[model samples]
Target: MKILYAKDFNRVLDFLTINLDGVTLAFSTAENDRSFNRHKDYGINNLNSIVKDFNINNIKYLNQIHSDEVLVYRNDFENITDKEGDALITSEKECAIGVFTADCVPIIIVDDKNKVIAAIHSGWKGTYNSIVTRTLEKMIDEFNIDIVNTKIFIGPHIRQCCYEVSEDLKEKFIDKTNIDRDILFKGRNLSLEECILKDVREFGIKEDNIYSLDLCTHCEEDIKLFSYRKSVGTYGRLFSFAFIK
Candidate 1:
């Protein structure tokens, strides 16, 4: 974890970032007192500070709706506000694509071989509906990205340890995925990371290329992140992004 001080906002920006093959990947962590977000409904307002601190430019992002929608950027960064999607993909250089999340999963897929990258917001709904699956498929088909050459970074989110859900909801996921109910449930808690991994492997991505962090927004004692459940809808959001610059 690294800290970036945004003097303008007086924010102690704690975040993690890594660069691989010209693409930069990052996510913001917050103390319980404040949020990293600023937008109201749908826009890049929330990403302004985070992007600036990272020195990222030509930003492209989405007004995530927790759906399976995936957008392929085509110089339409101007119309991002109208785009209601959970994932954004592009091969454009000097532009960063991103998504916002609290307890939901933030995923960044990088295909350096083909110069394609994706930023995905996968909440329970998006996970159940296979948002990442759709995004990967789009990248493979449209961008001609080779799955084997791609590396995935799973950012901070509510892990099974803190992501307790209704038994009915757990059963619902089992019914939808046909995945062993026992494998997904840890005494009424769910592992979104597991769900995401199943889809990643099914797409032929090797485990060695997939990197996931164990940080949980709800229960992370160190480098705490904003949690929707923990804050009861008053929580701030984390911004996850990736791009070639």
Candidate 2:
């Protein structure tokens, strides 16, 4: 229930200090924001301010290939990639991870017991490739994190009510995973949220452990959720971020 908006960023250090358990979760909105995310292949320098304020020195980022590849950030200092991938996970508290999004679903995973966290960017491409499932697997294999005990928060994105797609796109979603197809497309509704939640359930994550923001970025124009589809071509992105405190 703790949500931080873009305008409140000036108080980042103060916000993080108010510990609802030192796991400060914050994300940027499309409004009152400043970031150099003009290039699709880069992150914003403004985000560096957040990282510094949060006391994170080791930052991890990916190129976002849109495939099922989950990048693991292990080192404290090194050159990061600009390649295309979907997700990132790390147990290092020394840094924060970044995921830029216009309308893509950004996810945060926190295993409070083990002090592990994950940041994932899931679009239709990532969803079809089972990126959520892949993230769960990586956590188990690498950090010995118990999926049953982990908590996940699904951030705002385009909801099925407005996220219309072609039959070809729908077909790819169906072929890529085993899900209740009826909920996927109800005449014109393509339930990406439902599909992702379903995949999370399939990965043995408890229903209670999954939290859905349930807000449609496309529908909330004034709120600045940054709808790439709505912008057509000209717009900046809201960088979704998460870290261990």
Candidate 3:
């Protein structure tokens, strides 16, 4: 199964959406999908609007900290927007779990069996710590999932094409991950996509099960996809969510 454009995307807020195997995934475009951002200048919290548009109430979100922390979603989870974590996994149906990103990678994961789904925020730090793999391990522990049958989807983020980094940091990443140096680094620029693929593959996920939207947030400034590297102060974030319908 593939993640395709929703036929009704334009009918709603123009967010990119796709449904497959009884699951619905939605991602925001900076143009029309302005989600909850707390910056007073950008004050972009449209929760009521999102609920009205998507018709999902038990939407779980996180206050990401660029760490390897992952959570198992619960009905009584409190201070959700203030909770500290980088990933969420659940087997629950209809309730959407989401992550916010601005130049950081947003990953949506599903079991090949279609019994579980996950949302992750992987920044440079989170990627270095293998947040994706951690989430997958959590899925295995919580839902008895098989890593080989897992499908991972990568959303828009800074790619090697424009994700230039410091020499020390690049060297550190090169030393931390087992991915090929050439594939992970493009002359000091990092590929969050390749790094994630390497991590997932290490756990036996087949190449066919991995897909990336392949949009470069840093390079898509004109497209207005909320790139923190491309924006001045007071930038907003894009929301990416998924649920098993």
Give lDDT tens digits, candidate 1, residues 25-131: 77777753434453653334546655566676677777778899999997756797578999999998878888888899999999988889999999999999889
User: What digit string (tens of lDDT, one per residue) describes model 3 on residues 2-49?
Assistant: 332334343347467766677777778788637457444443346435
TM-score for each model: 0.88, 0.85, 0.89
On TM-score, the leading prediction is: 3
- Error of model 3, residue 36, in angstroms: 3.0
| lDDT measured at residue 119 in model 2 versus the true structure, 0 to 100 | 84
Of 1 and 2, the candidate ahead on lDDT is 1
Positional deviation of 156 in candidate 1, in angstroms?
A: 0.8
Query: Cα deviation in Å at residue 79, candidate 2?
Result: 1.8
Clash list (residue pairs), candidate 2: 63-83, 64-84, 64-85, 65-84, 65-85
Q: lDDT of model 1 at residue 239? A: 78
Provide backbone clash counts, one per model.
0, 5, 0
lDDT of 2 by residue, 55-97 (tens): 7775567877677888777774365556557788887776777
